[model samples]
Target: MSLLLAAPILIPLTAAVLCVLAWRHRTLQRGISIAGAAGLLASAVALFQQVSASGPVASQMGNWPAPFGITLVADTLACIMLLINGFLAVCIVLFSLGGIGQRREAGGYHALVHGMLAAVSGAFVTGDIFNLYVWFEVMLMASFVLMTLGGQRGQLEGATKYVTLSLISSMLFLSGVGVLYAVTGTLNMADLAVKFAAVENSALAVSLGLLFFVSFGIKAAVFPMFFWLPASYQTPPPVIAALFAGLLSKVGIYAIIRTFTLIFSHEPQMVYTIMLAVSGLTMVIGVFGAAVQTEIRRILAFHSVSQIGYMLMGLAVTGAAVADGLPGGSVAAGASASASTSAVNAAIPEFAVMALAGTVLFLVHHAIVKTNLFLVGGIVLKLRGTTVLARLGDLYLTRPWLAVLFMVTAMSLAGVPVATGFWAKLVLVRAGLAGGEWIIVAAALGTGVLTLYSMTKIWSEAFWKVTPDAADLAAAGQHPTDEAIDAADIGPRGVPIMMTVVAVMAVATVALGVLAGPCYRVAERAARELLEPQAYIRAVLGPTAGRPASASEPAPAAASAGGVPSQR
Candidate 1:
């Protein structure tokens, strides 16, 4: 399990090095990169097996114990995320094979993709807060490179804005870490959990929490912080944009969940109310933006922001429930109410557990389907040489498989029944209802319908419409698109073999639909582990029973007395 945990980080790093060193040989670099992706997939499988049999796995790097040195902890949550990351990496590599040709800087592309993989996988597994910041920087750097790979005027403009905003976020994240270390005196997440157990209600805690929230919320593209995403994402190629759409923002959501559950669980009222308000607005505004966009990619990007709102809705509702249960809260509002009783204790964790689990599942499902859709868009571009809905039409006549792929993805995104998306929406909405948040439930369901509307609009314009005007093609300085009269070669027939394999893996979309029950089980277990992080704390702080002294203090005399002892 430990070896498998290391592989997600190491395989990418190793492959990146090989790609850079063998830059002159594009084929060799590509081969190494593909093998690394396969290794990551195999490693994820191995890690999942160990987790299923033996529960969570923990590894301390370089013989240094937790707190003092880096620790990689692979609970069900981390492992599940690793699996998604691995799967997406492999699929994206396959998509890029033909899309980014030998003439391009294949090595640079491979290096950046692998580097981003390593960063995301590391962030999922890291036990230390500072380590998380490091991973964030690494991920941002790689993404910046990939964004600018084509070096077109639009890409350069987009990359500049993207990199600038990301750098500001990173600096804010660092500042938050600085404050956290000063207050709690530990960077190890588990160690800090113990160290700050008593301070979660303090003014400093809320202030620091907001700093961290802003940093991650910006990355997650939640509400007001999301302008950068739509602006920059539309500039990248569909393949890269698809990966970003599916994976990047999810990282921010993950961080928000992690911090709130593990570190700020103490002050539910103040922290939670704000979260709920923001989440509601995020969904409302994001979907409306999608409604207005005519461009295919812009609508998808806006939708990304909106779906993030759903995840936060679950979290906010759960937080509110938990808040009501906190000591000296509104539970005593009525004379008949018992002061000792908490409405939150009765239902909060269950709602939170279910909501978070659903969110993660949704993320995994979205990544694959979204990537397939983007790549399919690329295929459409290649065949018809245009993405604008106004210009492109009659795809169903020529590229039926691409049309089929689009329907599957669009239906999945639309939350149709018997699909993985339905399951995700079911979990999220049920969670909202369980928490008594009817407004959120209505919004979520309404968003699902709106999503369908937007998707169907594209379907009508792009595939169902009459054949495109060859005149538009001539206006755009391109050859008139032939009606894909041939069936076999209709959808990218002459494209590289690897692209075909990638398109085939879109079958996972339907497979996940079929396996929703078991996957939900995984998500539930992962969420349970995340909410009750005693195991993580124990791994970091030597099985201590109570919170540790401040970070500046020497190790507790008896390691077990505190939550976990730093082995380092």
Candidate 2:
């Protein structure tokens, strides 16, 4: 069980190590990268299966019990995320083989990618908030390097913005952890939940919650904090941009979802109100930003920000079920009433589950679809030598398969009927409406309309538009686009390696749409676990996990003598 739990992290870490050792041999590094990603996907699937068969699972280090040792856990949510993270790593690795170029490859590109993967896996599985922060740092460092791999002027400019914002977020997160640990004296999330809830300092609790919210909000790139994403994501290599598109902000969203659901859930109304507002603005602003962009990758980069808004809406559009109490074991533990506000927070949100399911499904859909878009953009860049829309046209007539692949993901991104995007939007809209969140529903519907516009912009500029010939370029006073890059092959195996990736992902996007039922069900089940986290708590901290320690019980010296201590 422990091996299974560690496999996802270990495989990627080992791959990174081997990549470093074989840095001189790009072939060996590439081989190891592919193998590691495959192993990660395998471990993720096995973990998901084990969790399906036997509920949430936890593994402690050094044979130590919960609340003491470093712990790795896999609830349904974590399993699903693990699977997505691993799946994308494979796709990105394969795609990078062609596009990442020899300069970056020899500059530790494969090793850094694997390092980022390992950190992401760590973040998903770690049961400790402090460890979550640690993993975030690892992810940040690896991404910072990946962002600036080639030392291009554009890469450096983007890396500056990315690292600057990222460091601020990390600082805030570490501060939140410091405050949380100072107050509760435990960094274990499960134990921190119970202990933090038992604290009587309302000011401290609410303030800390908001502090953490701001920290994660910045990372998640909500509304006002989203400017850095478009600036940075579009600057990297297409494959790297696609990887960032697919996974980076979603990890931030993952952190937000996990923290809000399990730890600071007592006062959800504050988060609810704030998230709805942020989500709406994020959606509109991001789409508007994308609408005005002519660069294919820049437009997709802006769409990534918009998509983050959609994911955050899941948590925003919870329920009138808040009136009934029972949000996160808060009310039952007599901590249900809002400590910050007088609004009743007895939450048993029916729509919350559905909304969250929409989030998970969309996360998967957007990761595949959005990344596929960037990958396709890379195809254009390689074929035409530029991603600027005005220079290129008539891909549909020339590269029909590429056209089809673009449409596959583009339609999905637009939320067209029968695509995964449609169902994801439908579920979220329904959930918001059911919860009486008219603003969220409107933002969702309105955003979809604008999302369609963005996709159409890309379709027209990048594909359907007729080719601008050399004569046309000179007539229009433009540079040569297809001069040296006319249908040119990419990668060691040429176009096949790159095409295979887009083809595979396009198929997966359709499969997820056509078979959205099981995926949604699993996501919904995970939502239930998140809303009612006792099973998760118990799985990590034994049977007594969610239960608050009584003053009558004997105190433990470690974890501030107020934690749910080791029983054996």
Write model 2 residue lDDT over 1-568, tens digit each, in one string.
8889988899999999999999799899989999999999999999999999988888776666667777788899899889989999999999887877777788999999999999999999999999999999999999999998878777788889988999999999999999998888778787776676677665676688778878888888888998899988877778888888888887898998888777876653555677788888999899889989988888998889998888888877752245235444333334552232222312465677898888888788888889899999887877667888878799888888999988878888989877789899999899888888888788888888888888888888888998777787678776433211223344234566788999999898888888988888998889888877777777776764454452112332233222234321
Per-model RMSD to reference: 4.9, 4.0
Q: Return the TM-score for each candidate structure.
A: 0.89, 0.92
Off by over 4 Å in 2: 319-333, 337-347, 471-493, 548-568
Q: How accurate locally is residue 463 in candidate 1, as Cα lDDT from 0 to 100?
A: 90
Give stretches of model 1 more than 4 Å off. Answer: 329-349, 472-505, 545-568
Worst 10 residues of 1 by lDDT: 332-341
Local distance difference test scores for all models = 0.74, 0.80
Best by lDDT: 2
Model 2: weakest 10-residue lDDT segment is 550-559
Clash tally, candidates in order? 6, 3
Model 1: colliding residue pairs: 541-564, 541-565, 542-564, 542-565, 544-562, 544-563
